[model samples]
Target: MVSIEMIVAARARLRGHARRTPLLSSPFLDEIAGRRLFIKAECLQHTGSFKFRGGWSAVSALEPEVRARGVIAFSSGNHAQGVALAARLHGVPSVIIMPDDAPKLKISNTRALGAEVVLYDRAKEDRDAIGARLSEERRLTLIKPFDEPQVIAGQGTTGLEIAEQAEEEGVSSAEVLAPCGGGGLTSGIALALEARTPGFRVRPCEPEGFDDTTRSLASGRIERNATLSGSICDAIITPQPGNITFPILKRLAGPGIVVTDEEALRAMALAFTRLKIVVEPGGAVALAAALFHGEQLQEDAAIVVTSGGNVDDEMFARALALRG
Candidate 1:
């Protein structure tokens, strides 16, 4: 399990490396939601996602000799770029295993960040087996996307920041919503808020079809998504929540929030138009919940953590076309 102490230490390591993205607000958004709305623009973080914090935390926590041997991670896109760039910054080699159908921008960005990119068929090949083979062959450290303690601890730093930011914004209480995949970010934030701000609660947000985390929370056990590759919110789509992360979420997180793919796109469009922040569909899920699912929320103020902004130009154009 991830502890607040671990999160604090991760923040110390990330002080110079990771960005402290701002907490932003728009009156227009507040009016639409009929409550105060704040956006934690993590999309502006390094590698255009919050995954960089976890990447740096895990890589930096490794022993010098071990880290020098390099690192490996399997991600659809966001985590791949994060680990790739973190490895590059540490002067270590990185091997990224990605789905062949992952966004072109993410694949190219990972390569440009100086990692060896290996493509696999998401529908047929097993990414874990491939990662295992390559890690053994190259003596590379495998960074599990969400299950690792260091990664979860690193992600918790965002919650710490939110706590402080909320205090600064005079928000004594609010529901903090974050896009959920394997529950790393959601659980990490939950742990942080569990200690830092008892009044605040963490909520996991997801697209309608890939609501495994949401269902898992309600059922008190892990649940798997029927299909993983069907949503435009692919960044937050996972087979199920992580063993380490699910337990944390079950203990500390509030009920999960589900939004439609179209709702996510509309949130992205609103973010672009109102805040001028480009958000990917998966990244917009939390904001979508805050905006469109107000009836499900229980606070006068809502804080949304926009997870990533790594969408392709064409996909971004499609989001903007919604204009909702």
Candidate 2:
């Protein structure tokens, strides 16, 4: 488990390295939700997602010799680019094993960031095993997307930022909705809030039919999704919660929420119309839950953590064309 102290340290280590993405305000969203609805615009972050914090956190923690040997990671998109960029910044070579079916933009961006890209068939090959083999063969340090303590602590930096930024905006209490994938961002934010903003609660939001984090919290154990490839919210469809992240989310997060694919599209459109921001489907789930499931949350005010905005042109057009 990662502590608040580690998160604080991560912020120090990431100084000037990661962007301090802003908390955006939308009067339209406030009117619709009937509360002060602030958006934590993490999509504006480096690599277009908050995953860079964790990648930088993990890679920067390595000993000099180990760092020289480099790092490897497996991801559908967001984390792939994050690790690639983070390793590049540290002068460390990175190898990314990504699903061949992952978004073209994500794969291209990862390679452009200077990481070696390995493609695997999601339905036939085990990405985890492939990553492990390459890591062992190359003496590369494996940076697990969310389970690593350093990664969690680095991601917790987002929560820390939200707490401070909210206080600056005179928000004494608020519920934070974050997209869930292996519970990394959600669990990390939950811990940060639990320590700093005691009145604020972090809630994990997921796409319907892929709500493993919610089910795991309910069942008091890890739960795996039935399938991984169906959702348009491709960036978040982790098979199960991380062993390290699940316990933290189970302990710190408020009850989780799930929204449908349509709802996510609606949120994406709304983000563009109201927030003037672009958000991918997986990243839009948090705002979707907050928009469509406001009654379920106890708080009058909330922060929707928009996690990413890396969609292809066709998908972006499809999201915008979606009707209520």
State the lDDT of candidate 2 residue by residue for 89-190, as single tens digits.
988899999999999999999999999999999999888789878989999999999899999999999999999999999999889999998888988898
Question: Which has the greatest lDDT?
Answer: 1
Write down the TM-score for model 1: 0.99
For the record, the alpha-carbon RMSD of candidate 1 to the native fold, in angstroms, is 0.8
Candidate 2 weakest lDDT stretch, 10 residues:
315-324
Tens digits of lDDT, candidate 1, 1-324: 578999999999999899999999999999999999999999999999999999999999999999999999999999998899999999999999999999999999999999999999998999999999999999999998899999999999999999999999999999999999999899889989999998889999999989999999999999999997889997998999999999999998969999999999999999998999989999999999999999999999999999999998988888878763
The global Cα lDDT (0 to 1) of model 2 is 0.91
Candidate 1 runs further than 4 Å off = none
